[model samples]
Target: MTLSREFKVGLFIGCTAIIVVLALLYLAAGKGVFENLHAFTVSSKSGDGFTEGMPVVFSGFNIGKVQALELNEKGIVLIKIKIPDRHVKWIRSDSAFILYRPLIGSARIVVNTTNLNSPPLDEKKIPEVIIVNDINDAIARIEPALERVTQIADNVERLTSNLSDPKGDLHRILSNAGKITTNLASKKSLVEMVVSDEESVKALNDSLKKLKDITTNVDRILTKVDKMADKTDSEIYGKDGALPQVNVILKDIVGKLQKLDKTIDNINKISSDTSEGTKDLHILRSDIDDTLKTVEDAVKKLDAIIGLKKAPEFKVP
Candidate 1:
């Protein structure tokens, strides 16, 4: 069954055409060529090295791809994305587009629309900026905090080392505490002595109570004494009191005693003089004796009137 050259060539061409058509259908299916596409454009300050054919993810699901990329005159990258019209409702004016690069993967363009109630995004709208999830940048932002933490760790290490040193104040305090504990452990008799002195403690408490009672009694006594002193002072030194009359009487007595002393002095001088006759001298001596008798009789009458017989000794010189 060998065929002619022309027939063989036609058959080969048909087979090749069928294979090419099948290949094209497979390629179209893989590219989602049958799906309805909605065209939109996004502008970003930085594309984060995004190129054409990058997958556009929504909620971790690959929903579309970047169809084209171009830079405008302002040097902003414009990305044209093709998403299925079935997902058009997920795009909103408030939606955020991010060009994120993980620590170990190529850069990606993600679309997030948390509030779908907002107005739908306009066609060919240019996005504000490109946001990248760069771990290096995050770490760079936390560098100062990390440095502060490192410094704090160093200070803690130094403090711990100082606390551990036997010569440090903390070590000394711990040593003193250990010594106190050891002393308490060794001196069981001290605890027993304190425990056995219950009577002394009670005695001390009783003494304190007695002292308080004595203080109270003393205060009452002091109050009574103050009242008595006040009464005595009022009675003694008040106007129209007996003490005032006594003081006046004593002053008058002092004056009278001074006059009597002058008289006695004059009489003594007269007695000492020898210019008179002896009979006149005898008469003068008799008058002096009579005057003394009269003074003694007057003093006796005064003593009887003032009830001096019941009084203590009355010294008259």
Candidate 2:
């Protein structure tokens, strides 16, 4: 049953040809060769980004393909597009086609229809190919955002620069903190760290020592004052203290005051009696003065009556 070498070679060639035909069929089927297609033309200014059999997309779905590319006598390039009859309803008279050459992926021909119910597209009225460069759009979209990011980065860099500057507040504070920590770790006192001079430290220590001595002396004086106060309290308030003697002296003085009050009452009574005697003497003196005046008037009248008759004889005798 072994075949000849020539027959085997021909069999191999036929098998290879069958495989090639299947591949062609597979590729053509993918391009809608087996299905009915609706044809339309798209005129473009340039056909630089077009390819044959490229999928025509409608709303993210592949509905047709670019059938052929040609140039007319007026130097305008015409792209023939074939849409499946089933998808032809999506193409309206006012449908737009965009040749989107993206920055990241392969170029595509995109279809955008405003209304699915609109009149069917006419074959005579060719759709214009709108070229869109993704790179340019990307640059346009990214320019403002990139500028804002750059502004924010510049602010951050300035902040960092200020923070790191030797003359800045943050750096000065850190330097001070470092010196304080180092001084403390090296067993230098807080005053020593602040004053820097040993003589100042010695003077401060001397002053503190003098203050301590003055505090001790004040404490001793306060103790003595407290002892004196206790002694004074006992002397003034104890049972055998001067307070009881003072109370006895005060009682004796109160008794003397009562005797003096009685004596004062007796003296007031004697003054009243003496005032009564003086009033009687004043009345007796007034009566004696009246009697003397009457006697003198009678004598003056007797002398006037005797002087008429007796004076002539009495003068001779």
**Model 1 / residue 93 / CA error / Å:** 3.1
TM-score of each: 0.37, 0.43
What are the Cα lDDT values of the candidates?
Answer: 0.76, 0.81
Clashing pairs in 2: none
Cα lDDT tens digits, model 2, 1-317, are 99999999999999999999999999988776788988899999888889998888998999988999999999999999998877888889989999998899878899999888889999778879999989878999999999999999999999899998889989989999998898878756778777877789999999999999999988988887777667666765678755565566557556655665665565566567886665555654565565555556545654554453232321110
lDDT of 1 by residue, 1-317 (tens): 98999999999999999999999999987777887898789988866667898888889988888899888899988889888877778779988988887777776788989899999988867776467778768788899999999999999999999998889989899888897677667654554344455566668678999999999988988887777667656655678544565566567566666766776786676767656534456766776676666567655655553453233342222
* Candidate 1 least-lDDT 10 residues: 308-317
Who wins the lDDT comparison?
Answer: 2
Question: What's the distance in Å from true for residue 72, model 2?
Answer: 11
Candidate 2's C-alpha runs over 4 A off are 1-3, 33-54, 66-89, 96-107, 112-117, 126-145, 152-190, 210-317
Error of 1 at 1 (Å): 8.1
| Model 1 residue 182 lDDT score | 73
